[model samples]
Target chain A: MPRFSSNHLETLLTAVDTGSFEAAARALSITPSAVSQRIRAMEALAGQVLLQRAAPIRPTTAGETVLRLARQVRLLDEEASRALDGSGAAVPSLPIAANADSLATWFLDALVEVRREADVVFDLHREDQARTAALLRDGTVLAAVTAERRPVQGCVAVPLGIDRYRAVASPAFVDRHLPGATSGRDVLARLDAVPLVDFDRDDDLQQGFLRRVVGHAPRSPRHFVPSSADFARAVELGLGWGLLPESQALEPLAAGRLVELAPGRVADVVLWWQHWNLRSTLLDAVTAAVRRVAAEHLRPSPV
Target chain B: MPRFSSNHLETLLTAVDTGSFEAAARALSITPSAVSQRIRAMEALAGQVLLQRAAPIRPTTAGETVLRLARQVRLLDEEASRALDGSGAAVPSLPIAANADSLATWFLDALVEVRREADVVFDLHREDQARTAALLRDGTVLAAVTAERRPVQGCVAVPLGIDRYRAVASPAFVDRHLPGATSGRDVLARLDAVPLVDFDRDDDLQQGFLRRVVGHAPRSPRHFVPSSADFARAVELGLGWGLLPESQALEPLAAGRLVELAPGRVADVVLWWQHWNLRSTLLDAVTAAVRRVAAEHLRPSPV
Candidate 1:
């Protein structure tokens, strides 16, 4: 007999998917005791603690390896069911991680196209671009739009494009805070003293951009707007200056709502499509849509 | 000597605020060893570990108690500096937690108004409506906009008003999925069969609405659009039917882009303003602005 059962792997997936043993049992149409038993059986067979039984259950490092195996099994199982029935009855849930800016601007457009003909659901895990690939490694997501160039152990990285961000502020904000500062040199000198907007405390883009302009990330009054749209809106509303993606900034810049602080200096973040190494039809469709739509919106990220 | 020193408390806040001992040293113009020694000294004085020595350091439960004390001391010290200098050079950074929707709609308006007068910066922590108060409990944020009506251990809750949500979908979506299903009964009967949008798996608004309309949360293909504005936009693009806050739904509904699925059935989420019960002038100003602006946009939550 094999050490792992397909049923137990699925139970582990369901438990993590629904976030609790009870919810997983309800989802799988099994008793909570059965869910616990399957998990325990898998742990006993593996000889390691595979899960952290907390408020919302989390898979341990050892469990992550099992989870990757389980996801591949589930994908194959769903593909087989579709092949057998051709009814589009079993919907595949694709878990993908993405940065907030991409999600707001162009990522959903790909999913929209996928949902047009495909019978599928999506679980989008929002993380910073730098950390999105960790989700892929942890088996939390099958794919990710990340800044990571190298692939995870069981994943392949495909270059999406460069997402360029420029330092911009509302017309009124420039008038008030950065008065008489127009050119790159003028702006860089005054940039540290003026207020700015950040996505959150950990959002180092603004600070990073400032440091590139000046020597150090000097003290500045910052407003933390956590939402992508609202972060742009806060800058548009003259709250402070911020670095916005070209996708979000172009139209507003054309409309005379925003002005560039420095003309030539722009931060370019190269994003990549990292997905599990799989031969499933669902993964192919998602990757195709993501690549096609991303090409339309993003600049060339040539090596 | 008092058990705690203001310098030690500030060090703790700086360490947590900068998210690293190395970064805190850079910010405070101190050596990394000195930073470690300060944290160790605080831990020895308090008889417990104050900060987790890891990436993006977090405070333990005992550390939270010290964090709150540190924050209070910092607030008082800043207030004193401003009072003495009368120059507004010592700008205070107020950390506040809020739901995504409120941040997207009326919450930022209050911040904009506050910025027009005060010279303070803001750090906004985004959490779900159910979990925001946890930030206050853990001393991560000084204030919060929460659905939690009961005050945390050392906080006060004031009614912020109600955010009303209604089931809505783009007209094209309804035309495609719920064809000729005009009445509430018609839509509710087939709602479970149609694809839906959720903020995330943790978002139970749509499921709760479905359970009220039907018997159970019947399986439906779901799209997780996590951003506050993007979630509304996804529904507008006809990806899936979703519950939209009236503030977001009103214009689209008026413009005939979106149609109400269940006209009279609405989800009313009451919001409350919770802040640390402190005598500082900054908290008073923030609470006043939050109350004043929230009054303009939200419905009466009289109780």
Candidate 2:
């Protein structure tokens, strides 16, 4: 097999990807003839016609093989540079803009595995679960464990499963707020009217729970705690009753730090994993780890 | 806004992504102290604690914003390089391994779009649809449009919808080959037993269609045509019956170039956009366009 030069491979890949020799030449700062010759050389080396020289040229089967390899070479070269530099991180840190509850509960653990094994890193961006995809579209993160299923532009969505949340509060908070509250909209309205801790302005967990329970959301003065742990702490300190991740609230509930505001009726937020569409090795490895963890932990979404 | 250097942003992004200053420093070819200093500098500049500085150094919200920007900058730079290079012909052609049917149909159009727009070129590698992931795992394609939902290790899957295929043959081929065919199984088995043209040794469209028509795939002598257009032409030249893309077959069949062997029973393959999970702006833009096209053309999965 003729060892195609890196320059040739890059050129051929670009030409085939770009479709026309002229366009490819322009992009590479070479003459169109240079692009043509390079492609010819590559095709000769591959022992097959790599591109169909149509209006916008397309790759032949043989061409696709080389193009894939070219991408790998670039990625590997980048990783190598980072490795050699010692000041540049080789492991691609996937910035995941996720909700606080997911972050505090299972998401962090998923990240831990990726970090330990994949030689990658993460920048976790906490956002309202409903709005995580906004971060994705804004190019804030490479991937997000989000609550949205509709993919952002230039991104793909995978069903990461659902997080079931129950309305919980400290015993003292519940006692002070709901004193022998009876059934029906009257009692539920009372729950809604009380002070509640929310993740942010966009958090629907508390309101969603209320709409389901009392036929309408709790019209309470809300405190946006933002951080999952901090939000939980606010509920524990009797700042207000709020929705909490079942996993995060377990220990605190057991120790009487919180109480189940609603026994049966709670809210379930379906979470999806949305990531930027890139052919990235490190990101891929991390995504796999996250998916594996999500499948194990989160509830299957109805949709 | 403080003009955070891409280098500084890169370092901070690496640390957050890697989960520790030490590991991030190692990846970036720098010392932990330098990583620490950079993070401190960023935090001091932003007037917010960007990193938690705990066991696994986690990025704070502000830190995540910077990290997201870093990814964007890097991706943009790569795309800019591809654009400037035109076809990337001056360098080694980037290999892009894809399935046979995609090469025959929508994939080429997508590549044409990339050519006209991004100005990069491609080296195409054609593999069996079921086996493209292996190529990716083996470091073949930088990006792939694969059938696998579970991503290959170090690769991410973007849903590109399905490629529906129909078992097709030339009218002359069918007339000579399947004389007095009644039962679908016998007809399919006989069809499979006859010599057929395939894209390659790994081409399963013929056998896979046979298996679907009958209960099992019939082993038969096959000629590998390799190229997408040639594969379609081989069937048109009365060589054998095989699965062809509906899009490619439409013209041929209408022109009496080929005939549908299995009329009602069309095999629909769910095609996904799988690429190296790299954070590249150009890749993202290309992926977006591809997905839009796939959605417009391909059938949505019934499940």
Candidate 3:
């Protein structure tokens, strides 16, 4: 087995992180030729090509194995440095993935609390709930808030709690787009014809709920507002009716600015916190903070 | 010369848009075999492969030529349909790319105004200011709000306005991380050592300004908060000092919730509106609305 030496692994990480050899060299304070040489030496030992050499570099299958090993080594190294220094400022930033809605609503509070006690830094990648685990697989992030219940290969999963959503529209939007309906079933049938707002193309929360409501996703026109805050605001501006998370939907509902389109109906996304199965004290601190804050904000997970 | 037929072109567009032959078939109400056959026939006529057999479909160089043609045809067809039917609802959604800050602040107002006049819909893509133009090149978005002053090929660029940003920190953040400075130079001198908050790794506004201030990007610890509204909120919550656009920073600055880190110094991003050079009335409406709203919010571009 060809072991990846730490110096060569550092070069590999910088190359992929920056996307090109020349750029990586600038970041690592080395020449592009040196970066190319280091990568070539590693490839020769491994007997396989590591990078695709594309504009934004991508790792080959063999490279992924080495990348994971490199990341593990890096984490252990950082943990060791923190232990030695004791000042805690030498800790490297921990990369994590989170869904946009959670990041917008409550995840930062956990990070802020963590920062208050530890001199730590973070690199957050905003990803879809369905896709965040891929970051963990690629060794791009150490932790994720994801919808996937099955733990990624070497990670442990914990239930964060349910993020409940309800179909809502501005009072003016309800007056304009949806027909008045008295019964719950009547509203369900009418949902197939009205305009809706989606967080993005992959945002099937509205569509999935409509499918459960009317047996198929609607052919209705949609306005894709890719940001979580903007998606709620789009509904408030009467662009279209949308599913707003309970945290965002509640206040406006009470204020009478937004009205529920479907009474007694809500969409619940059961979010999970998944992190590397590692034993660093700093990682444990983050995990604890995330659990504490999530408990405070979210409803209990269903059995 | 192989000219693409309208039906075959529609198949191409659907396949690329949906990202797989099976998904395209589902979307177009056809069988996957039929979708594959149509693309094969088109490829045979062109004497070249059009699509990359990736999990999510990708276009080859020759396919980009065809993709551009298909988009132009689709826009024209929708325009003709609206004219002949005399009903504005036949129009399809327009995909547009914008940076998070603009989308969170001023962009949606333009979209709401555009929605009021036409029954047209939108598909928004949230991208970094530096990369929005690439969305226009790939046919993923018909238009973009980008920092690129030069127009993409086949697109026209118009000045939106200059978005000015200032480095700000919550009062508590300053009290902890920064030295009380007597002069502008002293503040600049101390800024290199403090913790900072970034929108993401590629957010260079803070780094770029720091480089100009003291001649290089800082090695300070950073917290990456990806959302625009939340990035500003993270700064206000005393996470770290960050650059905030004038629109988001002013009220908090006046209210003493946030304090300016670098007084009288601001980073200005000159924004441009770029769209396909097509004469569609709907595209014209979006272009006009964007210009009108941007003028209302942003500072004038430098001469």
Per-model DockQ against the true two-chain complex:
0.67, 0.01, 0.73
The Cα error of candidate 3 at residue A9, in Å, is 2.4
Please, what are the lDDT tens digits per residue for candidate 1 over residues A182-263?
Answer: 5778988989888889897657888888887888766887778888999999889888899999999999999999998898
- TM-score ranking from best candidate downward: 1, 3, 2
Per-residue C-alpha lDDT of model 2 across residues B1-303, encoded as one tens digit per residue: 678877887787567556788878877878989988888888788899877888667666666556545655544565666567653322222346667567556665565455344434344555666667765654435667777778886677877777778778877666666877766555665775555666543456666766656666455545444455545655666655677878778888888878776678787788887776776655776688788777777887543
How close is each model in CA RMSD to the real structure?
Answer: 2.0, 25.7, 2.1
Chain A fold similarity by TM-score, each prediction = 0.95, 0.67, 0.95
The estimated TM-scores of all candidates read 0.96, 0.37, 0.95
Q: What are the per-residue Cα lDDT tens digits for candidate 3 across B1-303?
A: 598789899999999988999999999899999999999999999999999979899999888878878877887787778778865445567889998899999999999999888777788999996678767887878899989889999999999899999988998887777657766667778887777888876778888888888886577777888889889888998888889999999999999999887788999999999999998888999999999999999998773
Question: Any runs in candidate 2 off by more than 4 Å, and if so which?
Answer: A1-77, A80-91, A129-131, A182-189, B1-303
Best candidate according to DockQ: 3
Selected candidate, larger DockQ, 2 vs 3: 3
Per-residue lDDT of model 2, residues A5-68, tens digit only: 8899778766754668897887688999988898888888888997889977776666656665
List pairs with backbone clashes in candidate 1: none
- lDDT score, candidate 3, position B104: 91
Q: Which candidate, 1 or 3, would have the higher DockQ against the true structure?
A: 3
Output DockQ, candidate 2. Answer: 0.01
Native contacts retained per candidate? Answer: 0.65, 0.00, 0.78
